[model samples]
Target: MLTIGKLGQAAGVKVPTIRYYEQIGLLPEAERSAGNQRLYSRKALDRLTFVRHARELGFTLDAIRDLLSLSDHPDQPCAAADAIAKAQLAEIEKRLARLASLKVELKRMVAQCAGGSIADCRVIEVLGNHSLCAAEHGPRESEGDS
Candidate 1:
C-alpha cells in the first residue's frame, strides 16, 4: 500500500487532485493507516494511472467515469465507448474551426498595427471595438477556449 502522495506521484497527478477525485467519486475513498493517513492499494494506483492517461487523451471526467463503468462491466457492448470518442472528435473539430477563425481575426488585428505604442495598437483597438468582432465566433461559437 502507498500513501496518497505516493499514489499521486506514481500516477503523475497532484495529491490535491487525487483527493478531489476521491471527493467527486472518480476515485474510491482509501483506507487509513495507523497514523490515520490515507493509504492506497496497487489497484488504486493503477486506476489513477488509467485516469491520467485518459485525461492526457483529452477525455472529460464524465466520459472517464462512463468508461470506468463500462470497464467494470466488460460484457457490455463497446458502442457507447465509440460514441464517446465520436463526440470528443466532434467537439475537437468545432474548437479547431473556432480557433482558425480567431487566428484570422488576430492576424487582422496585428496587421493593423505597425510596431506602434499601446495607444496606437490596432490589436487593442479591435479588441476594444466589439462591433468589429465577428459574430461567427465569440461566445456563440466557442464553447471552449484555447
Candidate 2:
C-alpha cells in the first residue's frame, strides 16, 4: 500500500498524470484505507506500468485506450494494433522531414547574416519578406491568428 505520491514515484509517473489516467478510466479507482488513502495491489502496479510505458512511447490517451481494449481481448486480430503503430511511424517520419527542412532553412538564413546591425541584418531582412527568402517556406509560417 502507498500514498499517491509514493505510488507515483514507484510507477515513474507524476501524481497528476495518475489522477488523469484514473479520471479517464485507464486506471481503476484504488481501494481506500481508513484515512481515505489510495492503496494498490501488484496488479494495479502492472497496469499502471503498462500505461506509463505506452505513454512514454508517445501514444495518445485515445490510442492508449484502444490498445488497452485490444489487450484485454487476447483473441482479437492484431491488424488494428499494427495500423496504430504505422500511423505513429508515419507521424514521426513527417515530423522528421519538417525538422530537416527547418534545419536547412535556418542554415541558409544564418549564412546570410554577417553580424551586421539590425537595419542591415540579412537574417531579419529575409524573414520580414518571405518573397525574398530562397527557401520555399511551409504553411506553418503564415496565418498566425488561425
Candidate 3:
C-alpha cells in the first residue's frame, strides 16, 4: 500500500485534488494506516490517473463521473460513452466557430485602424459601440456553462 503522498506523486495529481475527488465521490474513500494517515492501493493510483486524463481532456466532473461508472462495467455497451464524447466535440466546435468569428472581427478592427489617437481608433470605437460590429461576436447565452 502507498501513502496518500505517494499515490498523488504516482498519479501526477496534487494531494488536495485527490482529496477533492474523494470528497466528490469521483475517487473511492482511501483506507487509513494504523497511525490514521491515508493509505492507497495500486487500484487507487490507476483510478486517479484515469480521472486526471479525463480532466485534461476537458471533461467536467459530472461527465467524468458518468464515464467512470461506465468503465466500471466493461461488458456494458459504449453508446453512452460515445454520446458523451460527441457532446464534448460539439461544444468544442461551437467554441472554435466563436473564436474564428472573434479573429475576423479583430482583424477587421486592426485593419481599419490608421494608428491615430484613441479618439480616432477604429478598435476603440468598435469596442465602445457594439452596434458598429458587423457580426455578433459577443459571449453566448451559455458562455460559462462549463
Q: Among these predicted structures, which one has the highest lDDT?
A: 3
Cα TM-score of candidate 2: 0.83
User: Cα lDDT for residue 22, model 3?
Assistant: 91
| TM of each candidate vs. truth | 0.85, 0.83, 0.86
TM-score of candidate 3 to 2 decimals: 0.86
Question: What number of backbone clashes does candidate 3 have, counting pairs of residues 3 or more apart or in separate chains?
Answer: 0
Query: Which digits, one per residue and each the tens of the lDDT, describe model 1 over residues 28-93?
Result: 888999889999999898889999998987789999999888888889899998898899888888
- In candidate 1, stretches whose alpha carbon ends up further than 4 angstroms from where it belongs are 117-119, 130-135, 138-146
lDDT of each: 0.86, 0.79, 0.88
- Residue 78 miss distance in model 2 (angstroms): 1.3
lDDT of 3 by residue, 64-139 (tens): 9999999999999999999999998887888788878878889999999999899899999999998888788565
Candidate 1, position 136, lDDT: 57
Off by over 4 Å in 3: 111-113
Q: After superposition, how far is residue 27 of candidate 3 from its true place, in Å?
A: 0.8
User: What would the TM-score be for candidate 1 when compared with the true structure?
Assistant: 0.85
Candidates sorted on lDDT, descending: 3, 1, 2
Q: Tell me the lDDT of candidate 2.
A: 0.79
